[model samples]
Target: MTGNTNSIENAGDPPRRDQSEPRRVHITRGLVDVLLELAEENEPSEMNVVLDATPASSFDATFDLDPETPILTHFYLPSAGQSVRKVFGVDLGTPAGRGRARFLTHPQGPFKLTERDDFAAVVLLAVPPWDDDTLGAFDRSGRKLELVVVDAEPPVEEL
Candidate 1:
């Protein structure tokens, strides 16, 4: 079974996982809050985040199927005086169908929620209806949102 490590194999073909099998990537309470907050602000026309679970956690989760379905997860936030933080799981749908967006950050020091910059907040909104009028809302907002548009497709890996 020896082969070139870097050669272009049918690596694109990802083996499927049994639906009955339980998944390991459980969405934490924090993740749910982030997703919900973003969704409320965006109000996407369709789906939200897309999670592609695969047997190979590293590089075998991109295989496509008929209209991908999204897995929903919820979170709770306690510090902000809120009872819970709600965030959706993942969207396995197609580009033409549902959309996806995400905000991710890291906990530092003692995992205190008070620290504003303790987490690197990133929001990736996948809008299937990517139109000027739709996207313009964010672009023409009076509030300042720090965003950097990367020209190249950023590397896809679960952190």
Candidate 2:
């Protein structure tokens, strides 16, 4: 019933980061603000967003990560559910599929990731509509991202 039980493809589950991997993620406060803003814009309906990430060391469109490398979230944009499900249906021939730092906001409650969510996303969320100060980021496996809010976004034009 298992071949590489941890593989995202094996169970169609999101790839998990074990204790050996870097658990901390640094994201810009600006990005969180954007999420809250999007939430307001999409309120009454769940909002989905695609965020751009760069490894503190190395990263790729494939989202394969080095055990020791950390990640940072900078730029993000509003996305549709189907677009994210298909990586925007863009030509994956280039780095256009480069972001794994995607998000979906549920105006519901606390953070809880589910099977229906796009495996590549790490829903960094804040609730109560106006509470941008409170935020949470989690992966599909229920492991939390030790989030650090930074002051600025990266200089990349797009992801």
Candidate 3:
């Protein structure tokens, strides 16, 4: 799949870090497509995709996809749960049995994700439902997907 390298921030002084300010993160279409493909290939009972600011800090959304549609969809931040469901539609949580995706925040300070960061990598952890759990179910298994945002290709201005 072709990836788009669009920098989320413009050339200027970086924004000051303030806990009071709300930060917006951008997930590329390419990254979403890759996750979709992975879900289609390996049908897991539950999937956890986390967008983490640091190893210990993050926010996440989880979905229970056992039913024809998701039986339950939750978010670490209650405020974002509904909007995320609406935005992604049912496609995101359908393939995996009961998917759980999360966006993590910093452990100590406020959310530290900034445009200056090289790229944000999403870590996916897949597990089977308790009913299907086996001896090795406790084993930790997952994939780390990286998204690199470049500034070389900017959008053309309309005439």
Candidate 1 segments exceeding 4 Å error? 1-19, 44-159
User: Per-residue lDDT of 1-159 in model 2, one digit per residue for the tens?
Assistant: 465576556567666657767466666666777677767777767765666665544433333346344455554444334455586665332246666766666677656666666656465665555454556677757677777766654445555
RMSD of each: 17.1, 8.4, 20.0
Q: Is candidate 1 or candidate 2 better by lDDT?
A: 2
- The RMSD (Cα, Å) of candidate 1 is 17.1
TM-scores for all candidates: the values are 0.20, 0.59, 0.21
List ranges where model 3 is wrong by over 4 Å.
1-16, 45-159
lDDT of 1 by residue, 1-159 (tens): 367544457467575677455322222233344454554455532322332221222223342322232222322221232223233433223233322223322212211122232121222222323321122101111222323221222125455
Superposition error at 96 for model 2 (Å)? 3.5
Better of 1 and 3 by TM-score: 3
Instruction: Give Cα-based local distance difference scores for all models.
Output: 0.29, 0.60, 0.29
Stretches of candidate 2 exceeding 4 Å from the true structure: 1-22, 55-76, 79-95, 130-133, 156-159
